[model samples]
Target: MHKRKISIYCYLVSAAFIIGLLSISMFISYSKDPTSSAKDDNQLEYVTPEEVGYSSEKLNEA
Candidate 1:
């Protein structure tokens, strides 16, 4: 009888632990900002190497 009680307690504890882990994973997966991966409208425009005061030939050599 004592062994049966111990087994039941262990099973409940293990099940509770698994449930807690699943809930935490679900929360993390769902809590992310969906728009964070989208491109922003304020992005910088493209510029050539020489326009930024750097030589294109030297940049290519390195």
Candidate 2:
């Protein structure tokens, strides 16, 4: 009876430990992916407004 109680306790403790570890792993796994600002750092080429479609005259009105 004593050995059985100890074994049960040990099993419960191990189960709790495993659950804690699994929760931590899931939390880490679901966290946002690492993003790099390097790709987002794209520099657009400067161009005259007329080159696209906006007229310089209309731009002056604003």
TM-score of each: 0.53, 0.53
Model 1 misplaced regions, further than 4 Å: 33-62
lDDT (0-100) at residue 32 of candidate 1? 55
Error of 1 at 18 (Å): 0.1
Model 1 lDDT per residue over 1-62, tens place: 99999999999999999999999999989895776987777889899998999999999999
**TM-score between model 1 and native:** 0.53
Residue 44 displacement (Å), model 2: 18
Per-residue lDDT tens digits of candidate 2, residues 1-62? 99999999999999999999999999989985577445444667789999998999989999
Taking all chains together, the TM-score of candidate 2 against the true structure is: 0.53
- lDDT of all predictions, in order shown? 0.93, 0.89
Give per-candidate clash totals.
Answer: 0, 0
